[model samples]
Target: MSRRRRLRSRMLALVLVGSLAGLTAVGGPAIADTLSDKRAAAKKQEQENAAKREQLAASLEGLSAELGQALLDLQAMEQRMPQAQAELAEAQESLDRSQREATLVAARLQDALDQEVSIGSTIEQDTARATRIRESIGQMAREAYKGGGTATSMDIVLGAKSTEEFIEQYGLVSTALRTQTNTLDELRELQAQNANSQARLEAVRGRVQELKAEADEKVVEADAARAQAQERKDEIQQLISQQAAKKAQIEDQKAAAEAEAAAADAEAAKIAAELAAIAAQQRAAEAAAAAAAGKPQAPAGPVGGSLFANPTSINPMYVTSNYGMRLHPTLGYVRLHAGIDLRTYCGTPIYAGRAGSVQWAQYRNGFGNQVMVDHGLVNGSSLMSSYNHMTSFSVRSGQRVEQGTLLGYSGNTGTSAACHLHFEVYVNGGTQDPGPLLGR
Candidate 1:
């Protein structure tokens, strides 16, 4: 009976020890596990919130950069428009002057032609007068022949009945002959003068024709020059029109971007506030639980967050687009985006997202001057990052860089529609959604 009591007591002691171990496991390890799980869940939620915030920031940044570049382009075009207008005005003035000169030349040519006509009419009249004089001389010679060649002053004196009559008849015949000779001589002299005048007029007409031809040539040349100038002015105007259209489009985009950015920022702020509230609640609950259980509270801050830093010094305002399948801006087709687009202006500094060695630093097709970094590994995965559309780069292929290291300046190179950064993340050898990796 004594031996049976000892064994039962030993068994009772073992039972009590097992019961206490079970209680300790339920009260301590169970509570610790629950707290740890809660902390992990909260950290995950926080990371998701951070990722969303980052996306918003990138979008705002992209929009701002696009708007700024558009404004700059518009300003440059506006400044050049005035110069184009001035050139057009000058061209018009030149054209007008040419037309005026042409008109003057035409009038001069008409005057020259009129003068030629007048001179020709005078020559015709002079020619007719000469013909009449020749006919009259022929008639006088016929009359002299019909009256007999011997009918002279001596015959007139012989036929006279008295001395006075003889003297009068002789004087009359001599006076008639002398008057005829003088009239013929004057007709010949007038004909010769008319012929000389006609010759001079003909020479003047020839010179007038030459002058008119020269004037006509000048008019043609001036017209051609005016047309050329006008065409040039028109081309400039066309260029101005194109630029204006581009400016308008940019302005519209800017307005939209600004509105979107504002909304995104507000949303992000709201989300951040909510996350903060949740985090505070989680912290308070954890503290309360720890106090009740007589254990330490869970640590604060993000857990298993992104290792990469922002690729820019300034915090991005919003995300333009996330890496995924989307419609191409220019190609009008569904395609893989393969990267995240961040808002950035021309000349904005670009930085490495993680410490790595540069795999490539050169101009790439459709990506512009790009920098690709091989980060070796992150979270047991081979990771890589690329920065695209840079204006200039401070790093080179085979070079080493730390996180946040300046790589280059942002730009609108390659096939980009605006100035911005195309940030890409890779896992192993393939592209992946950069959102989660960025703690989005």
Candidate 2:
């Protein structure tokens, strides 16, 4: 054989050996179509899950808004209740005070009336006494005139036997005259006093009447205020009841959302398991081919020659770095890497390794433009994958997307040495080898 032919045969033998070494790692070709069908179905399911998540998020937000409004309204009602109760209590207390005042005034008026009656009786008695005294004086005058003017003061005085008796008689006569004059003056004074007392009693009676009237009006107003306050209290209670019902509804919604998320997780796990099985079968086929060729095999990891498509298919032999290595290009330190870096040109269209829904698409710290996808259920757990270091991103949060959709263009935005895609697969929340499954 020619020297060039010998080199070519040796290279082909090396390729065959590498294929056999990786065969048992994945599924075979007999289930390729089945696995593809399942992956398509899983993609559709993931899209549905994305839509459901959006709906649940919106519903939760609306419930939160309503709950907040209800709480505010309840607080307002609670604050008003105290004021209303205070007003009602003040009104009631005022009514009570007025009623008590009315009672006191009525008692005072009764006392005044009794005093007026006593005064009137005393005036009547005084007037009767004055009349009797005047009649006695008139009779005395008639008798004296009948006896003619001969019966004088000197005769009257001489009628006494001794000088002391005559002086006594004179004193008695003077005292009678003064008593008559003073009696008339006293009668007039007593009448004036009685009139004043009656006037005062009337005034007191009027005040009592006014107080009684005011008390009745206050009672009426207080009753009305109490009734209004009671109505308001009842209304507030009704609102509280409605809020409780709304809270229960929100709880129900939350439960449903949690259940949907659980179902999506379980479904994703199943799909991941199926994809793993198919990949194992394909790897087994490749390994069988390598054995028949009889050549040395390469290590089972990401390699340039693989069946998977890349963001840029050109220069497939160049690998930027291995996944589990150390060497921070930007920070200049040895750190364990979580994902493989594939070298590619800028603006390369990144594709999904397996079917999945767009879980997240946004700019993140240290990742710049990135996209994470939920592939499907595998082994009773959800499998997720991430594509980072992209120049541009098209998907949005809560967006529904399918496999093979244009994620973004490749770029070196994160901690990278060159423009490449940082690919990662997560199995049950832990990172796994994605290169072999992608046939890289």
Q: Model 1 misses residue 247 by how many Å?
A: 3.8
How many clashing pairs does model 1 include? 16
The C-alpha local distance difference test score for the whole of candidate 1 amounts to 0.64
Please give the distance, in angstroms, between residue 384's alpha carbon in candidate 1 and its true position after superposition: 18
Instruction: Output the TM-score of candidate 1.
Output: 0.47
Candidate 1: C-alpha RMSD after superposition: 35.5
Compose the digit string of candidate 1's lDDT tens values, residues 333-394.
45566678877878999999889899779876556688888775444445677888799999
Model 2 over residues 62-83: C-alpha lDDT tens digits?
Answer: 1233332433344444434444
Task: Name the lDDT of candidate 2.
Answer: 0.54
Candidate 1: segments with Cα more than 4 A from true spot: 1-76, 225-244, 256-440
Best by lDDT: 1
**Model 2, total clashes:** 23
Give the per-residue Cα lDDT of candidate 1 at 42.
53
**Model 1 / residue 319 / CA error / Å:** 30
lDDT (Cα, 0-100) at 28 in candidate 2:
17
